[model samples]
Target: MNAPVRRRRRRLPLNVLLGLGLATIVVAVAVLAPVIAPFDPMRMAAGPRLAAPSLAHLFGTDEFGRDLFSRVVRGAHLSLGIGLAAVVAGLAVGGLIGLVAAFAGRLVEAVLLRVIDLLYSFPDTLIALALVAFLGPGLVNATIAIAVSLVPFYARVAYSLAVAERAKPYVEAARLAGIGSGRLVRVHVMPNIGQSLIVMATLGFSSAILSAAGLSFLGLGVQPPSPEWGAILASGRNYITKAPWILIFPGLAICMTVLAFNLLGDSLRDLADPRRTAPQRAGA
Candidate 1:
């Protein structure tokens, strides 16, 4: 086999392929919700309240007679959007702080690292809850809270990787060549650490989604009538015994989405650190 083809085949593990497929399906559903959903997710009808799964309502009907399938489909938009947005925010802000702290003088590094440690000392959900409480309950506030809570995590990871990369011979050569500090870090450091950053972002995405959902479930995130999965699950909890399907579908959505992201992250981590596969490859 050609080298390029072999490289391509090795690039994606089975778990990553499955994860990508599952994630894609969810994204497609979320994107096409308006066209694919049979009923207005928020609309209520009198006849089918608490109905079981049927041709008319695949996932069944909620206590309010809203179509469960439509609600789940629509909720995907909020859940996935929050995950992606929060991860992007963390990557931008945390990544910069990390790079600066890694390359700057000892005083600056100490201060930044201490601040990150303070943030990390608290539980992720607790930090998010406090921020939401201060900012007031809403989707925007919840997203901000989640993003902020995740900053320390990304910052620490970036700082460690950047510090390690800075000691390499190429980095020393770049500095000796009189390359600007900013340019050196941007050009040399970032590209080398990009793979690890991507893997972290993928893993962080799952955490972000879970945090967002937890906030929503507590009534501190996306508010009622939003069709957010957490909010939907919270609403269904009151009728757990009477209407189980209402909770089941939304819960399943959360599980499947988180699982897919986790699988992708693990696969990416393995691919980024080739040493994990070195033994098997050597044997072959």
Candidate 2:
């Protein structure tokens, strides 16, 4: 018999690959910025103020003559940090509230739902802005505001998923077998919804980063002279006619990063649920 050829795996969408590649580059740049950047992110070049793209400064220099590339490089840390921290906070608050809402009687669900609704009433950016207004501007406060606002989203997602899982036959069987409420909820409900929770976290990360950067742009985030991407954008925006790269680079960075997570989340939605796979053909 002739030798059978192995089928090559299908190529992923070009956008997916590009997004992933860009994301990887951004991450590497962010993480290694300290070692890679030539000038201190804070260093102001007296002569290079508002300089455009050139050999000395790859991404060009801002109106203050601070190296735009270096600032953008360092700013990645602030943005990523806010996103990761906010998501972690969301996981803790939301996971607990969700667990309780799922198992507790109608009254508890009603109360949590009310709180969720109240939180949802405030637009996300507005809530963050208000909180920042009260707490005073800074990375920590901005992060807290973002995290608190995001908590309700995760809680609701967890609650709905848990409720669905609780109604499953296995859960009923466990209850009939005298499984305790705490253990039943923990053992049966959490595992089934874990994948969904992860998906939410990834999405939350992208949102949080964008929020943080936006806040920084408004001067409520990383603060002045720190070289955060948003702060850089804000500073360089006035000089857009002179040096557009300052705004362009950071803006693109934020856009690409957010898009990457979105694409990754979609891909993960497909991969995360094993049961979502198509039916297999019977062997001959």
Candidate 3:
């Protein structure tokens, strides 16, 4: 008589679930801004200037009398879009550079690593600020600056992970079997390193959003009249004492966006940890 084998299913952690839920809500808000927002985000006198939260204007009105809720909803597109675009750009370019350095000859690897190290020496924010200053202000340039600043981080992560995978017994076995370099990477290295890259990208997204917002706050990001979270915050700076709602709401939006992504990234890292998964595999 043979006993049946029960496949084990991993349950998501509570924090992960919460994080996913929050992130999903944020994405939905960004996607549905046109339909969900009660009034035009840019319309002047949507209500009384600097009105506080109420049923009529959920997040209240700005100093310019625009609906705070609508502006926040609309701003989500720009903020999230910049973060997403930067993360993708950084991940694609940096990940490719790292993969090449890992698999290429030692001379190539050394040169690439030195360049990465040089870039890594500066703080990411400083790099972004310098690039933005040089490129001039606006959404597109700000995104490019943030993406450039993020490259070293993803490059380092990808390089290390790929190197580790390359040294693995399975990868060595594949190489000895006369697999081509491209095929080897496609079959062995990439699958293993991919999850880590995704986790890093998730974490990096929060940083991108914060950077973009900071640049906008400094008047080096999305220009005026374009409903952006940081720009909204900037607009309210002078009205902090008189129209606290303006500052408070946008600040809260930024905080929520950052927090949601951070939580999601942390949860993903925990889920992907080998130590955490090992016990489940052993039990199964």
Candidate 4:
């Protein structure tokens, strides 16, 4: 076990390493936006309006003459912040629901699962859109909408994990030994499922960011002057033919961010698979 663990540690896949590097860079940029941004993100006339990318302005200027680069950098804060907050909220509520359903009587499980099924049937974007429309527009509303939309997915994943763990012989032994359901679940089930939840959270984060951006693009998320990536995309849609840089740069940022998260999640899933890792373990 120790040899295999050390072997795995020493042989990180290239794509996983790249994913980590990209994610780290993005986080660093988001954290240091205020210091690293050349000009104020909200400042108008920071450069020539609709200017092309150049040394003076790396991502050029938007229609309002705001520095596109600074705006994109600044926008990272809202995108990442909302995504993280929403995923955490979704996981908490959804995980609890799943845990309760998994441990509860058959009637309760049936009812809870039906509701989860209903929510899971719809597309995430559609659910978020409806929620945002009902809740009214803004960053707070968008986060809530995105989080709510994500609940069913997390709930299903949690439920599956919990039920499987509950059926294991060790869990049966714990029950025979007079372990309370709550203690048993907390001590045994949760630890077993934690890694899966981490992978799900990583994947869900990309979805949350994408959903938040979609809301912003539809004028239902972070409002203007905030420099959110989706808002930037929306603002530049009209200038696609003339000032393409305004759209291109922000789009690239979103694409890269989402891709980095997906790569990380895939790598984690691969690492967690016993079938894949067992070979390496045996070889080691």
Best by lDDT: 4
Tens digits of per-residue lDDT, candidate 4, 1-284, equal 67997676556587689888899988899999999899999999998899999999999999988999999999998799999999999989988899989988799999999999998888888888999999999999999999998888888888988888888999999999999989988999999989988888888888899998889999999999799999999999999999999889899999989988887876777778734321010000
Candidate 3 regions exceeding 4 Å error are 1-12, 274-284
Per-candidate local distance difference test: 0.85, 0.77, 0.85, 0.87
The best candidate by TM-score is 4
| Candidate 3 positional error at 153, Å | 0.5
Give the clashing pairs for model 2: none
lDDT of 2: 0.77
Candidate order by decreasing TM-score: 4, 1, 3, 2
TM-score of each: 0.91, 0.87, 0.90, 0.92
Whichever of 1 and 4 has more TM-score, that candidate is 4
Clash count, one per candidate = 0, 0, 0, 0
Clashes of 4: 0
Per-residue lDDT tens digits of candidate 3, residues 8-29?
Answer: 1133477688788888988999
Clashing pairs in 1: none
Runs with alpha carbons beyond 4 Å of true place in candidate 2: 1-19, 273-284
Evaluate model 4: give its TM-score: 0.92
The true-versus-predicted C-alpha distance at residue 272 of model 4, in Å, is: 0.7
